[model samples]
Target: MIIEELRDLIERHVRPDMSTPVEGVMIARDEVSTLEASMSGTVMALVAQGRKRLALGDRVYEYGPGQYLVSSLDLPVTGQFLDAGPDRPALGFGMLLDPAAIAELLLQGGAAAMPDGRGTPPSGIMVSEAPVQLLDAVLRLLRLFDRPRDLAMLAPLIKREILWWLIVGEQGATVRQLGLAGSNLSRIAQAVRWIREHYAKTFHVEDVADICGMSPSAFYRNFQAATAMSPIQFQKQMRLQEARLLLAASPNDVAGVGYRVGYDSPSQFSREYRRQFGTSPSQDALQLRGGELSLAAGLA
Candidate 1:
């Protein structure tokens, strides 16, 4: 019943406008055809009327109405909306997480007790059942869209409330570490940010590990634990993903696209690209041009 009510409210409020800050837009009417992965920004997503599936490395997750997904670090992720219909297309809201908001909430809620025993590393991403209060808070936030005048005055309060709920809710520990200054997860997240910003530039693992404040061995272990991919593998994914975008953008040289993304040898680039994407860049680009590539692979 709550889900149904929430669904209706979402359908009404989540308009097709793409002008919202933090990529908060309603994607209800169209069926997404591609399975694409982007540099996973830290964010929160709640589906009020549909199910969505996401793949991170070898692990996959699905969440539907009454559930929420949080990404604490930026990593590569393959995502698609899995279930929605014309009667009720997928209705959802996403807010890119602001680390400052997390930190501010931690400072405000400090009673000096670690309520969630959140001392260890947490998965980079997590999903948990939505608490009623949290869901209600979000409903009020969406209602603000109906009154643009009120949004300026009331939106911050509601946004803070959402962050607070996440800090104290079932997955609080994970959210908590997200803001902790020197937590392991946060450190690794720093390295992740560096890689995303400079994926096309060559960098040594030692330098990255140092930046994350971990020894090389420790950094590698934790990075793999969190992402299930080696640092090189993660960087490779970023490069290949970028290359695919470039290929799709125009009739460019495949070898040039590879080299532009830091690949030194065209032969090596073609081999790796084929291995990761299951088709040669030349062939995939051809399929993409002919409209024969599946929506999922096209997204990749």
Candidate 2:
């Protein structure tokens, strides 16, 4: 079975560091891990074994073998392996999405491959079934790890093929917009970047709207539609995620960490942190220190 072969290849090659000789490619494995909150960037994740769940805003997405998840924009997300064990670990492959590569393919294929005007607006994150062609491309990409001599010459070509398959898949419209400079997704991505860079500061909606060249109402609607969170909510997520990172490093200075991340009151920070992570900051940090939590859980 292709799934079995893929899982075997991953088990053989996946490093504890989650890196491969192929740049921007990684494999993940976990045995009954806990749910973790973190931020995800633009990437596609294909599950080869077991099941995983991700929570984004109010949406919950679950996928197992033969399915994939695509996060087209950066957003805070809660994710975990739903089912796994030492005997049947949750395994997955992930690759960073490159807009430049997608744009190159779009140019070679011409405008006909672009999304039509009637196409639906793209969301920030999406999940779709993995088609046979996509699975084949992914398998070939992983196989390159075994052929060091061919990796240099063939890896780029195979990666391009994988992106092409994604662009033509069921959620192709969303993937297509990712490469178009003037598309709504691209414009919203600019706004997302701004909010991320200035997460610690408060800003007016009109200001961010102007940055994206949209009216405040339109920006708010599109932002929510794309990210499933309001601007304030998005900022709060960033702040909280950053705070968690800080707390992991300096577990004793909870109040200082809260103030540094833009919270005015320690009680308010503790309350929101608990709301977002299901535990107080100090307790979460202690878990992190004790190895009960995995820092890599937040990363790809």
Tell me the alpha-carbon RMSD of every candidate.
3.2, 1.6
lDDT of 1 by residue, 1-300 (tens): 666766676666544552343233232333453565576567777777667788888888888888988887877888777765576577666666777788888888882676432244667778889999988887777767778888888888888898898889888877887878777878888888788779989889999999887889988988887777788888988898888888886535888898889899999999998887788989988877776543331111
Q: Which residue pairs collide, candidate 2?
A: none
Candidate 2 residues lying further than 4 Å off, grouped into runs, are: 116-120, 298-300
Q: Candidate 2: deviation at residue 145, Å?
A: 1.0
Model 1 earns a TM-score of 0.87
The whole-model C-alpha lDDT of candidate 2 against the native structure comes to 0.85
Candidate 1: residue pairs that collide = none
Global lDDT of each candidate: 0.74, 0.85
Residue 105, candidate 1: Cα error in Å is: 1.2
The TM-scores of all predictions, comma-separated, are 0.87, 0.96
**Model 2 over residues 247-272: C-alpha lDDT tens digits?**
88888899999988889988999999
